[model samples]
Target: MTVEHREAAAQRQEAGAGGPQAAPGRRRVALLFPGQGAQQPGMALGLYRADPRFAARVDEVLALWGAEGRAVRRDWLAPDAPDVPLDDLRRAQPLLFAVDWALGRTVLDWGVRPDALLGHSVGEVAAAALAGVLTLAEAAAVMADRVHHLASAPPGGMLAVAGAPEQVAGLLGEGVVVGAVNGPRQVVVAGAEAPLAAAEARLRAAGLNTRRARTLSAFHSPVVAPAAALGLPVLRSVALRPPRLALHSGYTGGLLDAATAVDPGFWAGQPAAPVLFGPALDGLLAEGRWLLVEAGPAQGLTMLAKRHRAVASGDSAAVALLPARPGDDGREAAAAAAVRDRLAAEALLPV
Candidate 1:
């Protein structure tokens, strides 16, 4: 690693009073950022209002989009926002990035140093930025371009199937394919609308439970090839560098390395690539005892982490900074504080 890279690693591993050496035998912290499926109405509005640092960081990220940023913040804060606005790629992509990036950022501002960063799907973009692989500006531009160009790809959707990836893969047709392998028994199929619908029917017929992810665009499949192809130039223009913190990538299903970090093609190809979050999580949890803190909306990633042997066996734990439901912002603020209090009790928070 270069000198700059080494410095970033130092910051993550030894920043603030919560650094590893600050408390002997404290579990190392790993922040988890959930991807697209976790988005919900009024998500994180509570924390955004309760925490000024989080709000500022979120505003800074959204500001990179100029006018579009203002509209997103406005819509995001509106109590009467559309019922399923989170499914719109244009809205979901940027807002999720802002929430994920800012939430993880403010935690660090409080001196809770993380040993590693992990994100699922678009959440990976936030993880990359926090890890020092890409700047917030670069991530915002890339995210904006993603929603823009992906509109060219024919309307597609994803179907989450339970009970083995092989079963789901076996049911796919020519236009549809396996999109993500989320866990031992959970996988997703992605394709253009008609084909994906047909595949979903087939999975249901086979006695597998299925649900569509809240996305208008089908990610992690060949249908996104056109968008990924179009976004190549924009991705390459960004000056991506090596990670400052340990980053486990869902794209590569392992620790993100210097070579892959700077590869524009690799970044562009993510849309057309299968998300192996299970494998990546396996690698991360195997490294050591960890306190996996979900910094994004919902407790989705935390629930997934709980299924792991490490967390199940009491070797590690997980916490979601935001709640699972979408009713009260006041309760949301209190919930986040309660989680942080638990972290403090565990010595994961700063001294």
Candidate 2:
């Protein structure tokens, strides 16, 4: 889950140590926010407690959740045992939004504003908020709305298959569909519990390896259509505006244009459509040699960003703010220091 590429700017610039040269002009910064399975309980907890600027931003977002913010804070810090499991969107969605937004804000504080924003699945809401498509409060409400509606949908889950989307397309049954095209060879199939299990069996029989995404409900699949459809009315009420900064849509696998930004249907329909994250990253990197920063945990987005063609040629680079998991006690501080050192080596840290 880490970038082992020896060609990485961090490695190349290691000898420079604390001295950061002017960064490569071609690689403008782009902050990446991760979605559901990408997070673990207590992810970045030390960073949150130690960094006031980061903590302030996180608190600001969670405050928008009102009284429920207390529960979100408590559960996220104590991932192992909580009133609601992090796998449940009801708890996961709002918390992820807060963390993602705060992490992005922290990067912005370093004086290098990102040229673009990209997010996967629930991560999109955070990206949208950061891009000015929706205010943080509005985005929080929309996420809360999503949580409420999903309460009635059939319980479902997702299975990650080792094949291209087309390779898995033929095996899909009634509820099973491509939930996400994560990489060149990985696609996640999702549906109602029974149907998803059946789909997994089919893929396994076909000699394709499969694993479940960490969740109790299937997002970005047909199984969640009912919930998405039901939330459209509330979703439409949010006042949408064009992004002040660039944003690539995981749902559309392209940039977020002004027209699409204001379209409530585009936002409401996200859960029902497959997440085209790989294509969206392609669009972002294709725009320019950019510094892609994973503003969330576990280096998941960082790993994905590193796989792009842009990174291989030094046209772009990627970094993750937090280490693999959170609640590591003493290790969290050390991990953050290491990441900052890497950034410093790449001259990506603020001059």
Q: Could you tell me which residue pairs clash in candidate 1?
A: none
TM-score of 2: 0.88
lDDT of 2 by residue, 207-309 (tens): 9999898878888887788788887888788789987666778988877667888999988888778999998887667655676778877787888777777
Backbone clash pairs in model 2 (N, Cα, C under 3 Å; residues 3+ apart or in different chains), count: 1
* Global lDDT scores for all candidate models: 0.83, 0.78
RMSD of candidate 2 to the truth, in angstroms, is: 6.8
Candidate of highest TM-score: 1
The TM-score measured for candidate 1 stands at 0.92
In model 1, where do residues sit more than 4 Å from their true spots?
1-25, 82-84
- Candidate 2's C-alpha runs over 4 A off are 1-25, 334-351
Best lDDT goes to which candidate? 1
Looking at candidate 1, the ten consecutive residues that score lowest on lDDT are 15-24
lDDT value for candidate 2?
A: 0.78
TM-score of each: 0.92, 0.88
